[model samples]
Target chain A: MNIRQKVSLLLILLSIMLALLPLTANRSFSEKPSKLLAEVLGADVSVTVDEVAEFIVREDPDVRLIDLRPADVFIKEAIPGAVNVPYSEFIRSDPDTWISNREVRTIFYSTGNSEADYALVYARGMGYNNCYIMAGGITEWVRTVLDTKFSGGRITARENALFETRRRAGEMYTEYSSLPDSLKAKFLESKKFSAKKLDGGCE
Target chain B: MKFLRQYPFVLIVFLLMVVLVLFRSFGGNNFRYDAARWAESSVKGSNLLTVDQLSAMTGAVLVLNLGDEADLPGQLRPKTVIMRPESITGKENLRLIRKHRGPVILFSDDASTSARVWMILSEMGMRDVYILRDPGAVAE
Candidate 1:
């Protein structure tokens, strides 16, 4: 075969790969995945209602709040600044439609729990970082967001614990100390690059 | 002549697999679970989208709670919901196959619900329908 044929075949294969690469891409989460994945990543994934509150208050840019419930339910009630993008829509790898700012931190949540978690997995497969799942989803959000007391529905105790942990914190920047020595240098030098959450759907 | 000269079967298999993955992901959660597990392995080392990972992502066996007709949520019509345990009678949920107007996706083990759904939709004079059976059930 000529070089042209080989090149064309190469292009065809390349295009196919590009299309399918993130077919299972996920960016955020609802449930912490199994232990093997959790240990390797060492990232705090569950987005408790209280963390949702903290994320909103501090305006953490590394976080983005996405609601994966159906449009009508989301229209009725959602986290203040959370954006509504039905989970079904993430069938494509494109995050631009759901997320306007690529680098901003994002979180996805739902009343059904795993719906947003599944969506976040698919988002990560799409090659997005800085995404997470709100652990108990909107059910927890309704408890913590409105009351600040973490009451109502089936909100989890672990969620409240995560909130308390953040509250007792000395320096948020200390999280970087856990990073490898090589990456820590870059992280410290670039103080402006620290992670923060985005608006969780406010009017 | 040119088609035969293409860079072997491995490349074709790769391309075909990618398309099927796209189709399955969009279709529903009936596949790709085991494959996603394998792909997840060495995730820190190399993030390759392999066939095993695709299977894991696709192999989703979901059991939706159709509940009883009386308990159906919201403005949804009676015929629209798959099967309601209360509305269905008898022990054979297979009856749901008779009542449903559209394709009946069965997630429940309740036989009475199945039979009732079947009868109602059939009485409504609907066909061209199908039943998405539970993965556990023996094929009829």
Candidate 2:
């Protein structure tokens, strides 16, 4: 056979192999993986900070929020439920200190958007499909809630902040108004701080 | 010109594969050794402790290799905080270590932390110690 014919045949074979690759092993069932992965994992592959903050607002977000942040930032203002799961130790049998059964949605986040995203992708590659990335992460949440700017969009940032302030002024209202009265008191008292959901999607 | 200089592409590919295999093996060796040692134990003269047996050694060992978030029963309590070495460091660990008294099983997942809290705790006579120093498993 001519060299061109042989190379063309080889290319065709390679194309066929590549086409079947995903179907065989790479086939992933991540629900809306791109949008969700994109939402959590930014261009460089880290989850955003705002996503982490929203987690603090989750109804019962307590899936061990691991702060895969650098040591320096971790010291400054590590969120209440966050335990630093520094990325340096990739092979640490128990990567994170809080190993409460992977059953508990172990949502991961970081100070930067890309760091957490890479970890999430790596974890997903390692067969950990139950993990998630926090939306916007702590940075966004702090900016929206703490700094008071275009937050929920329904109300002005100042108005939203004022509402939280007024509510807290009356009494630390942790549990929402929709919750039972007894639970409201419990939440208000347990300002210990916690939330659930990985800002990212399940891989 | 580049192809000529970088000739023997197949050889290069084969070498890459070999390097990758070695790297992967090196990565998991430490944990594999620990698992092996544990498996070797519980075998007085003949019987060996399977992984199941070894894990069972850590009584009430809750394996979190499953779902996302779980709700523990109001009464459930974990006595031991088995953790990898690189979990935390410095002042952060100082605050955390003092909080949990249950023996913190430090599985040498990687290099030890420079956390003085861990050092102080080690010196303070807090024992329930099991340090598996496996050089092969460089969780780096």
Candidate 3:
């Protein structure tokens, strides 16, 4: 073949490879669309602040709390044990690192419901069935679980249990939020800069 | 070989278009959830009413209690309509919502239930829907 023919053949091959990439190499391009509309219409996958607080308190290994806020805002104040996975970084990040396991109840939250909702849908679209959004997000968390104060004389056993949970959760939030700035900074710094170093393997 | 040389550009464009269509059909989450707009609305507190604020509002506000009737506070009974979250469907609920002239507030001992109710109402195009800040705070 002539130089022009060779060039054209190469271009055709390149085009064909590109056409097949989505089905092979770029697997994400083949994900099913989000079922959020149907899910919302049928049922909500919202987790309560109290439930999340309980998870933190119990140190539930099966539960993963993801904060979908900007790093700066997340660093300022966040539910303890929350990993900052800002919305922008979500699409680029690997799903396995945060949400591949169906057993883990991965809950997403933000300053409000929006970011969490967005992350929930994204995770659901990626086929993560255990994903949930923190209802009302941090704002509600602050107002409900953090600032909660039990009152009134009459209460049921169930109500008492709920109150006790809230009281404990509230104390946790206070203690975490009230830590000295230097200590908080050091703690945050310790958790900063995630880099998974892959060790080289030999046969 | 001759055809490839003659129509190289066309072949490339056609392949590219195929790839685009494939991605559109198979690419993740065509249902895009706009977080910015949701954040803006959430920040505005358009659909959220704290328990304290709800108590202060003096009007014929209809509080839709999603909790069991037994769990609902007696003080709220005068203006409360108890309904299960699963039962918040059909035209009957829509008519009940439409009948209320004042703001319709959703309250449940379970915050998740109330949040679901809020979402259902909002999805159904009901206006002025709000959820209580905390289910535990409903009594006060």
Best by lDDT: 3
Tens digit of per-residue lDDT, candidate 1, span A121-181:
5455334555677777766655544434444777578876665544433123233234465
TM-score of chain A of 1: 0.52
Candidate 1 per-residue C-alpha lDDT over B4-111 given as tens digits, one digit per residue, 9 for 90 to 100 = 445665466656776786664432212222222322311221322222332243222222235433332232233344434443323344344443333333333442
Each model's C-alpha lDDT?
0.46, 0.40, 0.67
**Candidate 3 segments exceeding 4 Å error:** A1-12, A16-31, A34-36, A40-44, A91-97, A100-103, A189-193, A199-203, B5-140
lDDT of 2 at A117: 47
**CAPRI tier of model 2:** incorrect
Cα miss at B136, model 2 (Å)?
42
User: Tens digits of per-residue lDDT for model 2 on B1-140?
Assistant: 34323334433544565566445333321111121122121112122112333333543332211112222222222532333332332345434554554434333222122111122223222333233223123222
Model 3: per-residue lDDT, tens digit, A1-203? Answer: 46686566666777676666534221231132223445643445888888887887788999988888888787678788778777666644555566766877889998867556646655664467798988889999989886777788888999888778877877777787777767887886786545555699999
Error of 2 at B113 (Å): 32
Off by over 4 Å in 1: A1-43, A99-102, A147-203, B1-140
TM for chain B in all models? 0.25, 0.28, 0.63
Which DockQ-derived CAPRI band holds candidate 3?
A: incorrect
True contacts kept of 3: 0.07
